[model samples]
Target chain A: MPEKAQILDQLYELIQPFAKEPIEFGEQTDLIDEVGLDSMKIMDMVMQIEDHFDVSIPLNVLTDVRTIGDMAGQLQGLMKDD
Target chain B: MSELLNKFLPLEAKRSELVAIGGADPFHVVVERVVSATEAIVNGQQVIMAGTNNYLGLTFDPESVEASCAAVRDEGTGTTGSRMANGSYGAHLALERALADFYACPAAIVFSTGYIANLGILSTLTGSGDVILMDADCHASIYDGTRLGAAQVVRFRHNDAANLERRLQRLEDKAKRTLVVVEGIYSMLGDRAPLQEIVEVKNRYGASLLIDEAHSLGVLGDHGRGLAEELGVEDQVDFITGTFSKSLGSIGGYCVSRWAELEFMRYAMRPYIFTASSSPSLIASTRIALKKLNSGTVLRKQLWANAHQLYQGLAEMGLELGPQVSPVIAIRLPVSMEEAPGVWGELLSKGIYVNLVLPPATPDGGCLLRCSLSAAHSPEQIDRILAAFSDIKEKIAPEKSG
Candidate 1:
């Protein structure tokens, strides 16, 4: 698995375009509540992440994911399997 | 307000904003009277119906009407029980058999509606530890069905065969347990799935496949068997699900499979077992409609001709449309959501009725004026629909600079 810090850095770059306004974010920032990515945007971002990491992320994993840290953790686990 | 209802406040606000700017509320359109298959009275004006999805235009066929009336008289109204209990009327069995014969599949199961058919079949077929690899642009029913089951669902890019193959490769041995799902024609953009390519990928991975032909039935194929038949890939597809509400001009849905194991799903599917079966009249009318559709070569030809006419007309006017010519044509409106309802209202005022689709529901978050042609639309009606569109060209199309 890639380092958690590395995953967070990549996620920040990927999610910036979906945010309504530019604002600083970190691992604990809520992807939905703080960053304001709607469900559709979130799905689009997930597809990008899947392609970037060459991992197939099951949608079931995302339901439990809320924070940026949660997403990084999920991505780490998915990448480890690869 | 209850805490449970608080989640809907944002949606309510958005709707209120839409309603405020509307000449006609897209969500609250009421058909006061059904004048014909191609016309309806909406908001006290007679408008050409272009979004009903009644492809074959058998909604008012004399034979279907007579059959429905006769069935109502002979069998009364609703089936008071589920198909699992006492509701398996002779007509229900006949409809199922007719469907099986139509598809040349070994077994078929009917549900109360198309949504339930997807829910039942998808949820029941796969369980814990299994994975469902579905197209990202699949319908809400397909997504819900995946969520209802214990299957770990992964989505490939819409209509992208290579993406599907890569995912299958990633799954490795787990690919055997994956059920790949796709729709014949995606509902929003009216684009067809690359069925032949998808089938080849599924075959390579040994993954099972299910296709929802909800929009493509009676709109494609040499005999209207949908994309599978159109592309000569029927035998390769494992399951075919479709709706009677579209081409068949009735209500209900069915899933036909080449595998006899589908017969097992009849009892195992909760959506099928717990829900009451379709009314006898519905089954009777659907039976008649299916027969009409089966031999509807002339109707299919007319439907395609109309589709090409509208598609070409819209294209010539510089209006962006869905990927290809289809009976279901969606004109992407180069306008904001605030202005879209007004454009649809303009059409309604000009005696034309088409669906106004907005963000999230639309493929690219663009506004769409969706038109679905029917065999019943006459040349004059098509001309009128075209003319109405031309009148609003400035409002819908982006301004071109020379």
Candidate 2:
């Protein structure tokens, strides 16, 4: 499984196309309110993460994710489970 | 009977408030005359038909009309019984063969209506033990299909292939038995499914895939088979369902597949066996429409042109739009839920008619002025529709413009 730093790097690259501006990936920064990830944008990122990690992240898992850090941590956990 | 009536008591009480705001049930708008594919007379006003599911605008096609007339003369007006009980005419079998050939699939089953296609297929294919992971924004017919089948239904985020995969992952060992259902073009949003990505996810999970091509058939792809063909994943799709109502300009629904297992559904599916077969006229007209769609290069081009023009026109007006440029263009209402009817009423009063979608029916609890463009709509009609939107927006919610 990849580390949190690796997951965060991939997350930044994944969101670039949908992000209106550069995203400041702070640990506590809300993905929706701070990173400006709307419903569509979040879905796009989820698809990229699924492909990149070869892991199927559940829809309910998203409810637990608030920030980019949470997403990266989630990805790390899912990858380890795989 | 009284207990049955009790269920709708609250909704019945809600009707007066709608009538108070010039909104009469929006569901039952009477059309007095259909002047053209794009023009209809409704309640004494000649309104532009920006709400029809007539994507290819071939409702008045001479060839289609002639075919329908010919079938009626040869085979009589209607089949008086179900397909299993003498309703199955020789033409019905022929239509199924023709549809299978059109999609290059091994088999196809035609249902009485587009809605019934899902009702029969989904209900029959999966059962109580199986799980169905559908897009959250799937058509009501699909939701009904799963319920009828007695399957555990789980909804993924709309158009999110990842969300779909995630839901399947939760199934674990049962993932192989799961069915992933999506639509080619969502009716409300007008956006397409990411077929390639979905196929990948399906393959990764060893799950099955079904796509409802209700809105995209004859509107997308070089072959006009639907979004599956457009994305070059036609072979990857396990089941492809579509309607004759939209682009075919007729009535009926079909599910085509490479697997011959679809033939088994004929005997097993209640919706297929018990339902009265499509009339000879509908089958003949649809056959011709399918053939026309196969060679409808110019027609598809015209449809895309019309869709692009309408989408760009609304976008230029600074109106909120769906994700993509499709035959369906939805303009958001920037007002309260109660104020939506006033805006819809004003649009209708101005000789422009669109599908007025309210919260609960609309996704994200939004209201929309759904404009479904047809190939038959003239360029002038599109311009007029745009002006109506601009005028209505400026009048209803002028503060948004500032």
Candidate 3:
């Protein structure tokens, strides 16, 4: 399994295209409040991350995920289970 | 302002801005009088209805009206209690049996409204540690049901069987504990679930499948049993839930299942046990309406004919529509959101009333002028509706219409 840092890098890459406006990409950047990704765009980005990591991230885990770093941790945990 | 009321400031501001646009308020349309199943006096003007989901238009069926009247006279008006208390009247049990027989299922339960049916069933069926795999485009009631329950909720891409398979595959042994939920015909777009493929995936993963046929009942299949019957997969679908408000022309909801365990849900569902049961008049009319819908071949034919006519007319006008021809046809506005209220207001002024759908409520955050056809609507009514849309086509798609 890839490290959480590597997963965070991949998630940032996957989420960049969904940003409606250009902004600094970082681990602590709030996806909804700062990056301005709407709910629909967030779902799309989640699908892309799911495909990239070949992991199924249950929505139950998404309630606590707000930043890119939180998503990376979730994805890394899902990958370790495999 | 109180903390409870402060949160509504943003929504209230949006409504105020929409009202300032100098058009009819889409949220506060007042129907002064009902002219018929197809026409209503809205805002003091008689309009052709294209938004009401009265697919079979049985609301004014002479026999049903008489039956409801007789029920009101004989059984009085309301049940006055929940089914768990003193409310399971003979009529309620009879309706449940009739619904079970109509769907050819062994067990059935009834709720006060369609929304309650989803809430009661979904919350009672699964518990903590269980997962609900639902289509992302499912109705609000389905979403609310998942939230009300303790189960883990996961949404698959809408109508994508491969995505569903991937989620189920990841669940592995937990797949058996998962409940997959989808709708027969999506309310907004009027698109249907790929039930055959979805059923296959569910069976492969040992998951149960529940189909909400709220929009498809009396609109699909030879016998109008909905998408499962239309796709010849009724046996594969474990639970079928639908509303009486739409096709039945009454107000109630039902869920029919072959599982003997569903009888337990009647006792366990808090939504059912706490809420008052459907009134006797509604139940009586629904009984007759279900019988009519069961054999509503002629009405279904006319309904489809009207759907085709309106769809073809809108498409010819260069206005966008849902993916296919359905009784529920939504015209996606190719213009800005600010322009939609005016367009909808203009349609209403032309004696045409359709639903004006905005973002978040819409699947894609786009504006929509949604129309649902009724069997009661005549060919001329369809023509008038088309003409009304044609009169304002340029506002919807100026470049395309030009």
Best by lDDT: 1
What lDDT tens digits, residue by residue, belong to model 1 across residues B224-253? Answer: 999999999999999999999999999999
Candidate 3 lDDT, B1-402, residue by residue in tens: 688898889887887788678467898888899999999999888999888999999999999999999999999988888878985889899999999999889999989999999999888788998989999899999988888889988888899999999999989999999999999999999999999999999999999999999999999999999999999999999999999999999999999998967998887899999999999899999999999988759999999999999999989988878997999999998766777788899999999999999987898888998999999999999999988888887778636433
TM-score of each: 0.98, 0.82, 0.96
Best by TM-score: 1
- Candidate with more favorable, higher TM-score: 2 or 3: 3
Error of 3 at B196 (Å): 1.1
The lDDT-based order of candidates, best leading, equals 1, 3, 2
Candidate 2, B-chain TM: 0.96
**Residue B214 error, candidate 1, Å:** 1.0
Q: Report the Cα interface RMSD of each model, rounded to 1 decimal.
A: 0.8, 5.8, 1.7
**lDDT comparing candidate 1 with the true structure:** 0.92
lDDT of 2 by residue, B116-164 (tens): 9999998989886777888878998997887778676667778878777
DockQ score of each predicted structure, in the order shown: 0.93, 0.07, 0.63
Put the candidates in TM-score order, highest first. Answer: 1, 3, 2
Residue B400 Cα positional deviation in candidate 3, in Å, after optimal superposition: 5.0
Ten residues in sequence with the least summed lDDT for candidate 3 chain B: B393-402
